[model samples]
Target: MQRFGWLFLTSVGAGATIWCTHFVAMLAYKAGVPVTLDPVLTIISLIVAIGGTGIGFAVATWRQNRLCSIIGGVLVGAAISAMHFTGMAAYRVDGIIEWRWPYVIASLLCAATFSGAAFAALGTATLGRYRIPVGTALLVIAIATLHFVAMTALRITPLRLSTAPLDSTQMHALGLATALVGLVVIATGVFAALIDRWTRSDAMQRLHYMAMNDALTDLPNRAGFQSELARQLGVARATHTRLGFVAIDLDRFKEINDVHGHKAGDDVLTALAHRMRSEMGRHDVVARPGGDEFVAITRFDDRVQLVAFVTRIEAALKAPLSVGPFATSVGASIGIAVYPDDADNAETLANNADLAMYRAKSEGSPAPCYYDAPLDELIRDRRELANDLRRAIDENRLEVHYQVQASIATNEVTGYEALLRWTHPERGSISPSVFIPIAEENGLILPLGEWVMRRACTDAVGWENDLKVAVNVSPVQLAHADLPRLFHQIMLDTGLPPRRLEIELTETAIMADRDHALHVLRQIKALGVGVALDDFGTGYSSLETLRAFPFDKIKLDRLFVSELEGSPETIAIIRAVLALGKSLSIPVLAEGIETGVQLAVLRREGCDEAQGFLLGYPHAVSAAGPSAFIDGPHIEPLPDADDISNAA
Candidate 1:
């Protein structure tokens, strides 16, 4: 319907221009006779002109069929000729006016031929380069040829005054007015066409923007990022220069979004984009390729200069972003890859940078690191481990090995720390440290965590002395809103008492979103489950964490225990941590007591419980319940000087 309306308007405008042109040409006639127009005939001629032009425009715009264009153009030409002839009939002369047969036929033929050519040009692409110019010339020639031939067709036999005709000034004024009307009609049509074209172009540009950019940050999206990177890579290859690519991931972004809501997340992204742009040079490109992930491309002089540039940009992005009522802290983990150094192509460069970035994040490295070939093995190993881990979960091949946690005072097994162990079909024993993080990153943690919790609880159902089973909870698990519900559901399903389940996390995990983690922890505790802070005193503000949150146990980090005998500062910090836990009524467990000296020191220092190879190594906890612990925990006698070599 709308298209028809445009066609109608176009036809009317064209018709008006042609009608005015014919009227103006008629005014130029000097028949030497008093002639006045017949109003009815003149009005009929305009109606024919408008109708004819409407048919022509309808055929041209609706289809590209050549035959249709020719037919429509012929009808338009016929209507135009009818109007011309009809207007001549309206020219009532007081004297006889003779019409020349040849001139009349020529004028009629010229109108049809020129009009058909113009319409044919509109219909087909065959005219090639000459289409526009030739079509335009034909139009001018048509008007000129028709008007002059028609004038010659009219001959005045005598001069006589009739109805005073129109005075010379009035005739000239009418001619000027008709010419002005023709110009106005043409101008209006062109203006409308320009506006329509602009509107469509602008809409297309908007769609292109939507396709190429991230809506949240208004930065180039993944497609745009990859395209621009490839383009830059071409330039670098051509010039034999180096290109630096950084894959950056904003840390704790999920926690921010989960704790503060999506609006805060968007605010952080926008601020980060602005910071990136501000810190980058004109040749640099920054893009938000995905959620909480940003990539940058820049030219570099060398590896050192690339590192320096990345460090500066990373530093700028570390500034706090204001999100509504409070300011949120966010930091980035960057992985750098250089062309001709780390990779030969854009895809490899991007992948290597991403791998490096994840490594920095997973290892908790403070500085951005360059891509190294040795790191590729670690990545491949993790990937293979992840695939195996998935199969381990599916094939019921996942096993739980319990490390005995003993009472230092009684020297008896108190409870067991259930550790996940995957003995891959090909790789044998794959460490939890390697596979667990990979699971978290690949989103296998949810199912893996559920299976571990359920299996551990199921395994501990009927233990001999009712020993508790402690399970480590990742920050990923804590971030889940359904974590508490899932835990209780698992408890119900396994029929294992909630009190027997101990969920351990670190100070850093709780600090991710202290209020949320605290809430989740308190809810778990409300269900009679124990919440312990694992790897305590290893992260920032261990004292503050202990003071602020309710914790049933504090597991001293293994590193501090290994360093205890060699470093006095370590012993001092250990004593301080023990003192803090004792004052708060929280039992402190020393981990990694490989040597008897370390165990004896932990005992002397009033540590409540301890676990390591010295006291007990991780052993497969049988589903046969209490017999697993009844078999007795591993124990080490006081180490002799000779035993120091095997302590680690």
Candidate 2:
């Protein structure tokens, strides 16, 4: 429509220029001037025509309304006519011809009629909307028809250049051609506009979809999940049906991603999404709310169906998945909350389910657990414990206990491993195995670890200078930015030489951030302190980890030492590890040496030191002094041959 209006304006302006130019040429001829066409005049006439057309095109393009386009077209035509007449009046004739009233009247009438026809075409084109080419063609036909009719009424002599008359057939053919051109032009303009609109709309729709979907899993994203949850909640309220929302998270997903590459992790998530979708009913909605997190919403007929449905989904997640070279087993811990039961709204329900899912993860299992008040209470207790842990170090409620490390060859005390112990005012004793991990997780280990190092160093100053004191360092503590400076300060404060302090770290700790760990270990070694790999065979330790760090000691995991007599594989693994340590100039210490046979085997395998209940149980600081416990073979003997055979 806009294009047609522009075309009409173009035609009207062109016709006006042609009529005015012809009338001025006739006037000059009547005045007895030699009517010779000059090159300058021709150029000026062409410029006027082209200028008028350009102005009309600009107006049509600018105005969207049909009426505005028509008015603009008429104004453009009047300007072109006036300019042409003014240029004609500039001519100097040889003699003056009388300005006859009849010629003047006829010329004015012709101008008015032509202008009216041009305006009519523009109005028609404008009414057709801005179909530029069609409007231009229509104006051309109308102007030609009006010009021929007005010419027939003129009293001037008609020129006959050939036998055929040039009036009727030529005029009719021109009109028809103009009309056809207008139709073609209008059709082309409309087609172009339609294509432009469609392409833009399709692009926008694709962008919208991309924004709402997860790139990795190709599932609805967090925004989409929230929208679906709100929609379902409304429907559930209206229909009085139960709506269940389950928040599911994969356990130890970060560990998997860290060990393998992100590409393998992505593949695992994609497979998990497909598995979840297959397990869900058609009406259920599943979405990836975030990394390794998925949410499901379903409208259940009753609570029983909801429970059964969640159970089925949990079982589906427990199945093993093959990713790249690894056959991995991943499980989902699901937390379910039903509408008007666990929560009445989306936010509350989602939050409560998330809290419950963490609780399920804390239980260390693959199962679905419904949200309840007890779980909330447990979370509160954990929070309290984290808060109280800060004061536990300052108030000296946390203390070090000594577990004796003895030489396997001589059966004499070599040193002691310093272990952290917490004695709660109200709860009595808390095991290091339990609270130590909690401290590491909640970021309390930075301070708690520093305290342990200082206390262990202070206590070791009391022991004989030849005996080493081992202090276990959690991975979180090892990752601390200021650990080197803190260790130096503790060494200065305790007046214990760096050689007397031995720091123990598990394999996982060294492998967690290999580069950073190496840098930290190098800094500690530069201070003349010894580094030991603790719980050596328990975690995913590549041979690279052992080769990278200069460990002074390797503590064999208790699992390998416990089954040494019963399983020949365990014994062989221990021996191989001991030999590897010797080859690297690192001493190997066997943990959990509880019997005579185990001790004898470790001694034969060239193990340097051992620590377990059979050696000496962890004792209080006062009982931790060198003279408090006996050190030689007479102190205690490992279990006899009968006991070892029965144990095996």
- What TM-score fits each model? 0.52, 0.47
How many backbone clashes are present in model 1? Answer: 1
lDDT of 2 at 226: 89
Top candidate when judged by TM-score against the true structure: 1
Candidate 1: stretches off by over 4 Å: 1-204, 251-265, 278-283, 300-331, 359-367, 375-380, 383-397, 400-419, 437-444, 455-481, 491-522, 525-648
Compose the digit string of candidate 1's lDDT tens values, residues 1-648.
768767776777777777887888778767666656777887777777788788877776666688887877776777678778877787776688888999999999998888888777766687788887877677666666777788888787765555554456646656676777677688879877886898799999999899999988899999988889989999999898899998898888998888999988888889889888888887799999888989998987667777777987778777777888988778888888889888998878888888788788878887886777797558756766778788888989988888888988888888888889888888788788878878987889989989999988998896767889999999889988789999999999999988888989888888898889888888889999999989876677556677777799989999999888766688888999899888899999999988778886777778999899876667776643456555666666656655443332
lDDT of 2 by residue, 601-627 (tens): 777678998888878788866754666
- Each prediction's RMSD over C-alphas, in Å, is 11.5, 14.8
lDDT score, residue 384, model 1? 69
Score candidate 1 by TM-score against the native: 0.52
Candidate 1 local lDDT, residue 295 = 91
Against the hidden true structure, what lDDT does model 1 obtain? Answer: 0.81
Question: Residue 239 in candidate 1 has what lDDT?
Answer: 90
